[model samples]
Target: MTNEFSNSENLFPAYNQHEVVEKLETGFKKLNDKFINLLEENQRIKQHNKNLQEENQDILRINLELNEKNQEISRNNLESNKKYQEISRNNSNLIRINNDLKVKLQARDKQIEKLQNDLNLEKQKNKEIQRLEVISQNLEKNLKILEVDEIDINTINVFKENNEQTNCNINKNPTTALNYSKGLDDIRIVVGLDFGVTYSGFAYCHVIDENMHTNDNWPWGVTGQFRTNTVLRYDDEFNNVLYWGARALKNRKQNSEPVKLFNLYLGDLPDNLKPKLPIDYKKAITDYLREIGMFIKEKICHLDGFDYFEDVLLVLTIPAEYSEMDKVIMRQCVYNADLIKDRDSEKLQFTTESKATALNCTFMFVDCGKYTTNLTTRKLVRNDPLHIDKVTVQIRDFYGSRLINEEFIKFLRERLGTCTIDLLKENNYEGLQYMVKKFYRRITRSFTGDDKKFNYELDILYEAPILLRHVSEEIKEIMGEIIEIKYNDIKKMFDPIVDRIIRLIHIQLLNNKENCSTIFLTGDFCVSKYLQNRIKEEFSHQVNNISVPALPEVAVVRGAVIYGLSTILYGTEFDGLKLVISSRLLKFTYGIQYNWKSSDDLTHNGKNCKFKTLVKRDTEITPDQTFSFNFKPGSKQISESFAIYYTQKYNIWYCDEPGVKRLGILNIDLSDVQLDSRSINFGLTFGQYEIIASARNERNRQEHMATFCYPDDDF
Candidate 1:
């Protein structure tokens, strides 16, 4: 208290002082405790402040990362928007292209419809022309008959003046009629006419000389050429002939188109296979034959001691696949051409091209023509006169060198547009022909499948400049003034045809029972070095020899002359000097429909309309073989008719089978036979060229000979 009241007393003051010191110590201790507590609390507050600062730093970093992610998402959205816009533009372009295509397709459809209409109109016009042609033919035939009668009178008069013995002989044998001329029985000259689809030629042989002569002197006067183009041209009305052969091919007029490949119509082909013709095919054939016949006649007349009416024998080479009706039509055409006086004249004989080619050699005959490839296998029977027998059925295919040209045309249509080609054909036919001719002459004949050595360029614009106007921009960009024909391009065209020919040869060899050691190639296409090499390479192991005869292009025509000589001089002094076809393998089974209820028949199963086979398929039949059959005449029947049918089947009971075909009808006169006669004997003789039917009465011994009647029989 006042420290004790200033000294209230010294003794009391000393005690107060000690008490004050203790109080001061107690206060100081309390203050020190408070200071330590305050210090500890200040340390905790500093730690808390440091933790808060770290949390604020983490929050700031997380916000910055989130902002970067938002910016990346914005960039992706902008890219997606750009892609969608680009797709929309592409869709617009596609729609425009589709519309343009639709327009072009409509235009093409319209063009096709117009072409169809034109074709129908052309068909109608063709029908009218055919009718007119028939009428014209009949009139021409009547004129020919009158001319023949006049010629017959003149011939008789000449015979009476030249040789009285000939007249006496003719009078003694009334059956000889006006044909009893001095040289009528002797064939001094034989002419072989090879009427091919692409080429035509004639070869003449003198019987005494035994040497063949081919007519190489054509209108163009080209040497070493025995064949001419089978091309013809008519006037604007198609009623008169304008040009023929090479001349027709050279002449390019706007009035009329050239007619080619008419020889294909001579076969009995399906309607789909037949081509459209500007004129009647028969007339076309007749006209062509007439032109050739005139040349032949003029040439023959120039020969010494040659008479066309008596000494000339024309042997026409026909396709092996021709039917009897086709043969008949050909014969009629030949007669109409004035090659022979009568349609049934023996002066004109028909033989297959394959058979004629086979007769020319002992090995297999392969004729690779422009339109067809014919194969025939023959075995050597006698080598002295070169007699050969048919070993296998003939094979004919439409694969030929012409197909190569077709493929080339397709190539052109592809390279340049089809419309461009069509326009060229329509505007400049000659130019189109020139282009094809150039390709055929330069490229097709020279390509050897060697790619490195092959470098050829065809001048397209020079030949057909008009095509430039019609070609598309794309075509122009690809092909300019010239078109390059590579080795692969040509090889692709040749391989298909070559493969087919090889396959045909292989099948023929496999079917042949005899070992085919040698192969003989003939015809124009055989001249191809590529074809020869391929055949050699393909059959090197199997075949021993492959020989291409000299002048193989004329082999068929020359062989035809030899065949004519052989057949006409058979069993004579000149027979040994010529090649003979001894036997032929029948392609079909020939039979006559007859009742099987015969009295002497033991194996009759009571079958009606049975097929009595006379010659079976694949059976080798000789020229002189005759099949005999006997049938009793009905009591009241004065005449009988037999139906002849042919089939490729072996076991056949009826005539109406799927493969059976009615060949012809045979008529027999039984009026001379008595009703009481047991049976009337009938005989059928099959010749290489014709068939003869004979009927004889068993009691009266009266014989009547007849021939099978064809469809369009004029004789």
Candidate 2:
């Protein structure tokens, strides 16, 4: 069967084999289709996965944008919070200020009430005085009715003397009779400021107390010292004041420079002689005055019933040689510093340093200041109010005590080489100042002319090692060693200044018309023992009474207070009881350039700029005296300007003269005056420190006043 089957199988096997091959091929084709399907599914799944990745990236970007927006919002909120906090702080400050103002107002109310009560009391006193006058009048009438024989002789004489005294008192006190009608009664306190070149001081006096009080408690000053250094230190740019007064001299800031001797700029100084200032001289002075004014206000405003504007009178002492323009500048500076209310404020008054010093006593005052020395001789005209008259012309010289300090500096420059001194000055200026202070304190103040008695040694090399490398070996050796300042070395410095002062005093005495009974040594330099001894030695024979008042350094300041008080009190009810400086000699001849008209002739002179004299130089003039000139303006003229000129010369014919300088122009407004009566009376009242020019229209009584200020070119 297997064979046959095999044969059949062979035939069948051939068909079967063909069938098996067909089946195999079909199976392989099925597997290939399955593989193709799987490949297509995998491709679709990969496309879906890529789409999911893109969606995730979009979500992540949206989240990042949201976070960035949130951060920006947070920053805006923080900035708003800061601005709100600043506003809140400002509100708090405003509330505090409001509270302070309320308290000040309440205090002012109390002061007003107190002043009202005083006014009432003064009125009652006036009524009582009137009653006493009536009773005295009745007694006089009864006495006149009685016969001489009936009345006792001694009683009659006593009654007559009493009547005469009452009459004299009534005649002298006209303002008192008027019951305080004048504004002089408003003065409560007077403060005097002596702003010296090297030192400054202030003195205050109450009108009621009439007792002088000086401020010795200056910042960084000795306990008993009345004056402080007039030095100021400014920042590098000079826009701000870093330090002032004694503190300025002690500051060691490397970038700051000290400004002193600025007071000299207020005088008629040559351009070369003026000090080099980083800032404007006026600004420097104004800053200094502002500080001092604040100190004064603080000191005086604390007193009961004291009003700075209404009750206080500030008397500022100036150099005698200061021109009217200089005085005006000082006044303007004072106004700018808030010391006075305005430019024309009467609260601020000026007096010469010499005049102020002379008010202390009738003597030859030798005020030896730092930069200038002034010699003035005054005669005691009346002792009741302590009236003094200037006898000799005031003399001012540059040979002051600072020259001694300069000589001492020169001595140091010689002892230590110039290079070493310059190096020290450049590198360590404070150290140099310290050395000078030490020299002044240890040697200069106590040194007498006698070398045998004085033995002092100054250590100039103690701070020199730091600068040794920059200097030469010779300078190094000199700086490394201490130098001995013997009495001769000091005497050499003192003799030049002291001898010049002595010569000035001698010349002053010779020129003085009145006998210089007493020679007063005043000012900061007057504190020097050597200066005092030398002055005494030189002038003891000429002046029998040579004296230095207690606290002589503050003499000018203290006398300034007296002067302010006396000026206000003089010619009033308090005339005989208070010190009064009644008269002063004019320093320059004041005149106006105008066309002189003759009363006899109707023709006008061709001379248009003729110099008409008003007040001559060296003429003794009282403060109340006025020289008046009548002027008739043209009918069409609306204003008339008078050109006032001044000169040291006795006589000048023309305004264009060499020595004649234009003081100022006084303009009189004639618009209000009647056309028929255009005559104006122009008057000039020369005071101790200023000239007041006034123009009055006779028809309308319209007056205009101005103070004489020299032209800018004169300065």
Candidate 3:
């Protein structure tokens, strides 16, 4: 306004200045209020962020806990599902068995009805006939009961004689046949059994006394004799056990027949031989072992110092040649005998005959016994001095003395003509067994490959009356008086056995790269002088020394005694182990089923072949080494788990080839686990004699019972 028009402008300018100052003060006050509000808001926001962060941490911890809980629930679910499937399978088997029995019962009922109709038609004619009919009806009812409790021999189709299959049926609620839980803590004595084909015995020792111990009075006549013949006899109908061991061979009855070479047939026999055996082979084994167990309980377990049944560790020695399935059957027999609880694997330990010999011998050993032969070597591993493991190397095991005995039996049968055959055909087998036992015990043990001959004179005094009535003049002339067997005839039997043993020795020498100088010979069959001489002569160049232990017959059982004692001493931590077998060679290829990486690799025999190998055949494994596999649930459903399937209808699906065996399914439950796409992990550790398996989820480890079911093995 140009200084407010001269003099007037001075007063206007002053007023304007005062007004501007007031406006500036107002603007400053408003700005200060806004700053104060922003500072308060900033402080409040910092406090809020701190509270949120704490809440987020709590939520994360809760999620972790929930995941852990979910994992545990999933494990439980898995276990429950496995149990359900097992129960279902068992129920199906029972149903099938029941149906078979019903069919048989219907057939019997029809037969009875026909008999009754005939009896009714002739009712007034004869009371004796009615009485006979009642007896027949009673017999029919008893036979029905027998069918329910007993296994039918004709139905058993034994797969492989070499690798016998065991019948494994899981019960809904399995209860221990014997009381094992009560006296377990009081165990002071351990026992070892050598269940052999030709002979059987046991050794025992106190937890304190480590030296070998044997029952001097082992069933038969003498005080020092520790072994008895492995034989069992059944009554007329083959439904009941009449006697066992030496008594069965010695005592001949009208209706009883001796079951010799039962151990060789522990697995099912060939199809052709199945019908010849009128009773279940597995049952026969169990029955025989039960009697043996009873003998042990009375003689050793019930001794003054040890009165309780469970206060003992019973170890068993099995043939090294036996397959895994065969071992399982033997274990089942032990369970059926009530010697130990069925599932108490820790209490019951099994050692191969060769392994036991290796444990006891200072050098390599050859165990030539009744049914099989085994070659073994022991080596020391000093890498871990504190827990030094004994590594046992088993070379070969195959059919041994029994094969030779069969050849001898065949020769005898040929020489004896129809004399023994006619008796067997007529169901009069007692005399034949008696004659064989007499000749075997007396002459067989004394045979040597020499010009000297043995005289086996048989007295047919009792059979003279029967022979006279049913004999042609030519046969009568040959069998008139005593039948004598000469030494040359016995030599024929020794030669084949000796030759076979020599071949085995040659193979043993070839396999042993170390040129082991010494060889130890032990077992009942090794007691034969002729066989021993032949082995020595054949291996003279390769082997520097071939020696048999003084107690060849009892060496295995005695070694078993040492094994048990060593387990007690060395198995503990505070007491250092003086002897131990740390590792062993793998006999077969071990692996698990798995999904294929691509569909192109899935086809086998026009079906899907899905599997991956974990352990290859002949691969060396250590106790510390672990094998693992993964199982991913494809579906979102919690109930779904890893399932095993077959590629072919009947062909076995194995990880490796040549001869593939069937595989069993693994039932792992994941029903309760929140699997937002997570995989289940499994691991395996090679134990002393078993492969230990474990399973785990994302959050925690899972517990499961591993059950392997094979179609060919079902009973």
Candidate 4:
């Protein structure tokens, strides 16, 4: 049983094993199926999740789109509100503007009404003025011309002067004026008359130029100019014209008879003298000017610019001693040329002969017309002339016009026989002077005492004085007998003028300072040695003088040239030249220092020993001049170059003082020069010299240079 049981157990065990195996397999299969199902469920769940996510995304997108639409609607509402607000504001502004405009319109209308009323009032006033003008015209129609003539006009001439300010408004250029076709085209001319107390000299200048308006084909200015001095004598109811100028000097025998109109007696009337009508002295002057004006218009205005000079500039020379009243008349007569500003012409500049001679401007001039005796001076230099810069103190009585007359008288008296001067000693003193002057004019040839020429023998000179004495005796026989008269009256007549001049000089020396100052003489009178001696003898230690020789006569004119040069070359270095004292021609030079004129007054770095100076004070000098001198090491010349000083008009003028009428100064400053280099060059001018000279050694220098000078033309 055990075996069979064991077998059955074995089989059972097998079956059991098999059954177990099957169960095991089945369990495994069940586990596998569950895992597969679980995986499939998980996949399905994932699919569901994906679907839900997609659906949520769609809902979120739709919600966002709805939000965007709402925002757009809100934005539209805001925009509408803003538009309405803007429209309201604009309406308010427009209303305010309209109110303001309404007010302005009302104000403007009122102003317009007022203006119209004022304009009407002005129109009414103008009408009233016109009515008054018409009444004035009616009243004038019955008035007479007063039979006015030159005599009456000249008598009241002082009141008629136009001293009003000269018109200065100017334009760049103007159109040409209308051509004149009036009367005869011939130009006329008249010479001026200068009546001196002792002698009457007439100077004639061309009143008109024959070819003034003629085509500028030829450059010959004028064929020639004529000048003469008329000295006539009576000859049995006839008057004979004596020689004029050189001719008068050469012919002496034929002019010895006395006549009536001899001397220049302004207030007296001569028995034999007659004019077309009764005239006073002043009347004659005007008549002469009038005649001259007419002549100028006729003969000079034919040319374009030729007449411009004559009509605008009427230059006349009067004695410096002319009364103030006479000056007024002369000024008026000059304007009588109708020399107002030309509507179509440039303004004319008035000037003197001295100014013309300088040639500072390109202006035509008439010179060599009338001449007066030239003054000469030696400039008496004393140690001190008071204390102040008594610049113009005439230190001495000089050889003047009176002296020339005296010399002439003395010469004639010594040669009375051959010159026939005794025939002039008539009862009337004026008549005597007249007759003598007439004869003396042509007496240049009366030196006919068989004068010996070319005596080279020195011994002959000793005998010459004896020969001269014999000649004098012979001359006395040829002339008529002379009757001497009291000379006291003649002396008395001239004493007052001489004394007055002396008084003026006396006053000049009374500066009253006990300082070392010099009287710098700057006029024509400084050239005379007699004047120098006079000042030394009279004023002595009170006055010192500085003279410029020939320059003083025309210093002002040369200064005018300097001024013109400066005017044209303003701001350029071409205006002036400077110099340093190279070598010593003199030591311890004496100079009169001017107060507050140079670097001392205006410059920052100033000195006490130096001052500025210029050369054109008509101090005598030469053309193309060069020189040298020494100043003490500390002494001063001109620190800031005073070579040329400029001016606005005719900066300076030269005047002649034939008698005792010389005085004045020249102006100079530093604006006229510029430094050309670090080293300076100087043109040294000293004393009154025809030529300036310098040398390294005055001891070795044998020859002194000389230069000849002519008179200056004042413009």
Residue range with the least summed lDDT across 10 consecutive positions in model 4: 164-173
State every prediction's TM-score relative to the real structure: 0.54, 0.55, 0.51, 0.27
Error of 4 at 679 (Å): 62
Off by over 4 Å in 1: 1-185, 220-224, 253-255, 303-305, 443-445, 450-452, 465-481, 568-715
Candidate achieving higher lDDT, 1 or 2: 2
Name every residue pair that clashes in candidate 2: 9-13, 385-579
lDDT of each: 0.72, 0.73, 0.60, 0.33
For model 1, residues 185-235, the per-residue Cα lDDT tens digits are 588899999999888999998888888898899865756678988988998
lDDT, candidate 3, residue 486? Answer: 68
Cα distance off (Å), candidate 1, residue 556: 0.9
Instruction: For candidate 1, report its TM-score.
Output: 0.54
Q: What is the lDDT of candidate 1?
A: 0.72
lDDT of 3: 0.60
Model 2: residue 664 alpha-carbon error in angstroms: 32
Q: Can you write out model 4's per-residue Cα lDDT over 114-202, one digit (the tens) per residue?
A: 67556644654564454444445434432323234444664344323321111110111121111111111122332223333222222
After TM-score superposition, the amount by which residue 347's alpha carbon in candidate 4 deviates from its true location, in angstroms, is: 5.7
Answer with 1 or 3, whichever has the higher TM-score.
1
Of 1 and 4, the candidate ahead on lDDT is: 1
What lDDT does candidate 4 reach at residue 287?
Answer: 38
- How much is the lDDT of residue 126 in candidate 4? 61
Q: Residue 179 in candidate 3 has what lDDT?
A: 20
Error of 4 at 270 (Å): 19
Q: Which sequence of candidate numbers ranks them by lDDT, best first?
A: 2, 1, 3, 4
